[model samples]
Target chain A: MTVLEFDRITKIYNVRGAGQMKALDEVSFTLESGRTLGLVGQSGSGKSTIAKILTQLETPTTGRVLLDGEPIPRHGKALRSYRQQLRMVFQDPFASLNPYHSIRYHIERPLQLDRVVPADQVDAEVRRLLERVRLDADSVIDRRPHELSGGQRQRVAIARALASRPKLLVADEPVSMLDVSIRLGVLNLLADLQREEGLGVLYITHDLATARHFSDEIMVLNQGRVVERGPADEVILNPQDPYTRELRAASPDPEKHFATAARDQGGAR
Target chain B: MSDALLTVRDFSVVYDVDPPVAAVKDVTLELRRGEILGLAGESGCGKTTLAYGVQRLLKAPAVITSGSVVFHDASGADIDVNSLDAEQMRRFRWDKVSMVFQGAMNALNPVAPIGRQLEDVFEVHRPAMSRAKRRAEVAELLEIVKVGAARARSFPHELSGGMRQRVMIAMALALRPQLMVMDEPTTALDVLVQREILRQISQLRHEFGFSVIFITHDLPLLLEISDRIAIMREGEIVELDTAERIWTDPQDGYTKTLLSSFPRLTGERGVVVR
Candidate 1:
């Protein structure tokens, strides 16, 4: 089933004196349940604009976003309901979390505001969510954002996003700021969550390697248009577009290229 | 290779917090003339701290406990960067050693034109140069970094992230400094733009004959661009070897794990190997 769909979405930003900037032009795609759609693009390539349109942070200049075969309302109770069903995870963990609030408050505030559970049971639910994100509830429940590592903070952010049990997750460059050692762990966690919770995810990133590793379907965006869209492996391995090929070639691979160079130089000479 | 441009010997940085956390511990490395030494590690591995310590860029509450950052001047005099006073350090910075920081896209003054920023670098380092000479030099610098001279008239917000980074590099290279410290110089850019920037840096290093201290968490990028690689873990330098060796024969398990964790683009088909 199509959990979320963007039908011919177009967003234009107009400066005071400058002409309109076409951020997203006639972009159309569908996000099904229990699947991830990876959006790859360079800076200013309309990936973030799509995320904004879906989250209702910004309305599209044209077209509409449908949730479960119905158009999302512009205002009133329906809009709030749509927002509650879709949650966003920002790129920077440091900026995403409130520095002053403890982890418990950060996790529990969303639950309380959304009225996910009774007031007294909010604490227990927060603890369970923390555990679900693989964080030790006892050690991290009272700690502030500053006290935790980047990986831990991101996990907490994920837990906070999952607090209200949203069906769709819009993670924008979620692992770009993290260390490589822990990046895979987070990606694996997201993959596992999608499988277990049947969540539909729109993972936006510029890193094609991670997109190939994580997403089931991939869309290559350049200049606010979809250049190619197919299975993640096919799009990565046999990319038809010149931009996708260039992006693939530009990605650094230490094991293959470096090893080839080493062999040619007779083992670093 | 007779005279090393920058020598970091037994360097250690400690954050004077409640537990007195050590960020960089007993790290030692050397950068020869015209060579690029890449520092590769994950976040919180002290690579940035080491970069700041080399140029004495650390703020208060962060203390350099031991060792020295010695730079060999053009006249063959060894100067300890850690011991320099505020005024001396100011003169040493940008003139002798400059840094192109991470997220250099946002480093520019949003309101100021790019030409003025480039001119500011020249004005601080070469105070004797005339206005005409500075303007001409700014154009030349921008051209060398592949950012057209026309962009010098535009504001920071008008330029793309890659263009902004090129402008930052142009500004850093304006003085022809002996050593340049780049911390994740290409992280803010896309893969193709990153390649272009790295290729420009490689070519410029060959032409300018200046050593580079490159810090980044991307191991494969470091392997591609660096002559030597230093792997840091926790707070210590776990392994330091040639980029080729670090790729094929890493000495530390942490380094090995980091290399393995990277997702390769060209590999076994249809398998999500992480």
Candidate 2:
């Protein structure tokens, strides 16, 4: 069953001088539990607009967003409860986490607000969340965000996101800020958690490579429009759209291109 | 590429905290006259400190305890960067070597036009040049980086991120320094823009025979652009070899882990086994 459905959602931002900027032009897609939907797009492609609409951070210019066959409420307690089931992981883990608070505080705040578990069980649940994200609760629980590495901080961010027991996660450019060496670890952790928890994930990113590996299905966004949509492998490996082809060509693969360049130069010498 | 442009020996930088932390330790490397030397490491691995130390750009508390940075000019003069006085270092900084810092695209002054910023580089170094001559040079530099003459009048926020980064590159190449030290130059840009910038850098390097000390955590990008790669772990250089050797047969365990951490598109997806 589809957990969240963005039904013909369109977002328009009316600027003073710029006039109306159509951020999302009638974008529509549905995400199911135990499945991942990758929204692949570059900057200003309305990827974040969709994420904002899903979390009800912004009201759609037109159309509707349905959750479990019911249209999402605009205000009041319905919106509050709807947000509990939907959590977002941002691009900058450093900024997302409060530097003043401990890792436990960040994770427990969500659990306390949502009342996901009993008062006494909150600590144990936090520990479980930490372990699930491959972080040692015993070592990192008491430490603030400043003390942790970039990778560790991201893991903590993930743990905090999972504290509310979100059914649908909207992670927008989550790993783009991370270093190359540790990006896979976080991606692998996300993929693993999605499978284990049977949660629907809206993985929004500009990168085609990680999206192909993590997402079950893919949607390519360009200038606030869905240019292409299909299974992840089909969209990535055998892309039909010209924009998708350009994205594929832009991806840096040193082994295929750089390694051979070195070989050719070495042979000539 | 036969002659060494810059040679660093036994360089170490220590931050004077309570216990004193050594950020860089006994790092020795050489950059040929026109070769690109890639420095690959994690965030706190001291790549930036090493680059700063080589040019005597380190400030107080972050002391370069012991090091020797020798720059060999085209006329074959061995100039010790460490021995240069404050005034001499000021003159030597951009004339001999220039740096494109991390997030340098945003480092452009928001209020001033990009043309004036490009002109400032030449104004400081070549004070004798006529205003008309400097204007012509500034326009030429902007065009060289592919920003075009029209972008000169535009503000920093008006241009795109890639164009701003191109302006930074144009300014860095303003003086035509022998060595260019870039720290994660294209990290902020998107994939397509990043590809174009890398291509532009490669093209610029061929056009202008300047040695580059390129530092980035992305090993594959380094392998693609750099002639040689240096892998730093903790505060030390664990391995330094040709790009081909480093890619094919990494000697150090840390190097192997660093390379394996990056996921690839061609290979088995998510196969970067910990």
Candidate 3:
């Protein structure tokens, strides 16, 4: 079933002298439960606008966001409940986490506030959340966010997101700030969690390489429009849009790209 | 293979803390004239420390414990960078060697227009130049980075992040130094912007024939751009090899792991590369 659907969503921003700016123009997509939809775009491509509208941090000028076949409520109890069902992970893990709080505090607070588990069972749920994200619950439980590595801190952030048992997760460049060596471990962890929990996810990133690896379906955003959308491999390997081709060219995989270019030059010779 | 433009020998830097942490340890490397030498490492691996140590840019608690940095000028004279007098060092910095510092995009004076900021470089280095000459040079430099001369009058806030970075690159190239030391220049930029900046740097290097010490944690990017790459780990140079050799047959276990860390779009998906 489709957990989240964006139906002709359009967002217009009014500048003092510049008139109306259509940040997202009739963007339509559906994210099924237990699936990942990757939004690939460069800066100022309005990728974050979609995230904001879904999270209800910003309102769309036109159209609607449907959760489980129902239009998302705008205010009061319904909006609060909708937020509990949807969670977000930001780009910089360091900025999102509280340095003063312990790991247990970060995770347990969410569980308690959301009442995801019974009061008596909150501790067990916190432990499970930590361990589920592949962090050592015992050793990591007492440490502060600053004490952990970039990767570990990110896992803690993921754990906090999972505490509410969110149905749809909007991870915005979730692992962009992490070291390359530990990036895959986090991606793999996310992939594994998506499999086991059957959660729908909107994975937003500037990196097509990671997007191709992680997402089931990919949508290429150019100047706030869906320029291309298809299965991950098809979009990446056989991209139809010129912007997608430019992105593929700009991706930092030098060996394969250079080798192909060299071969092409040699063949022409 | 070409003549060494700069040579660092037995360099070490130690922070004067309680335990006195050695941020850079007994390291040695060389930059060939007109070659792009890459320094690759994770954060706190002392790659930045090494770059700062070579140019005596380290401040406060960080002290150069040992080493010699010799710069071979075009006139075949060996000048020790370590023992240069204060006045000589000041002139030597932007004239002989300039550094594009990390976050240099935001390093421009917030209150000043880009034109005046560009002219400030000439004001300090080439003090004899008239106002007209400085304006012309600034315009030419802006053109080199493709920012156009109109942007010279605009504040840093007027330019986009990529444009700001291009302005920084233009400012760094204002004096046309023999060597440019860039520390994590494009780390904060998105992939496309980073690619464009790297391409411009490559083109500018080709046009001017100045050597570059490009430092970054992204090994793949380094492999793509550099003639030689030095891998640093825990303040030590673990492996130094040609970019081709480093990519094809890396000797160190750490280098191999670092290379595998980045996900490849074309290769086997969702598997640990090692």
Query: Which lDDT tens digits does candidate 3 get at residues B1-274?
Result: 3399999999999998999999999998888999999999988999999998899999989999999999988778888998889999999998889888899777999999999999999999999999999999999999999999988899999888889999988988999998999988998787799999999999999999899999998887898899899999999999999887888788999999998888776776756221
- Candidate 1 A-chain TM? 0.94
Interface RMSD (Cα, Å) for model 3: 3.0
lDDT of 3 by residue, A163-221 (tens): 88888899999988888778889988888888888889899999898899899999999
Local error of candidate 3 at residue B228 (angstroms): 1.3
lDDT string for model 2 (B152-186, tens) is 89999999999999999998898999989999998
**Considering TM-score, which of the candidate structures 1 and 2 is the better prediction for this target?**
2
- Clashing pairs for predicted structure model 1, backbone only: none
Q: What is the C-alpha RMSD of each candidate to the true structure, in Å?
A: 2.7, 2.2, 2.1
Question: Which prediction has more favorable TM-score, 1 or 3?
Answer: 3
lDDT of 3 at A157: 91
lDDT of 1 by residue, B76-185 (tens): 78898888999999999999988898989899999999999999987887899999999999999989998899888999999888999999999889999988999989
DockQ of model 3 vs. true complex: 0.54
Cα error of candidate 2 at position B190, Å: 0.4
Q: Is the docking of candidate 1 incorrect, acceptable, medium or high quality?
A: acceptable
Top-down TM-score ranking: 3, 2, 1
Ranking by lDDT: 3, 1, 2
Q: With candidate 3 superimposed using the best TM-score fit, by how many Å does residue A238's alpha carbon deviate from the native?
A: 1.2
For all predicted structures, in order, the TM-scores are 0.92, 0.95, 0.96
Q: How much RMSD separates candidate 3 from the native structure?
A: 2.1
Among all windows of 10 consecutive residues in model 2 chain A, the one with the lowest summed lDDT is A260-269
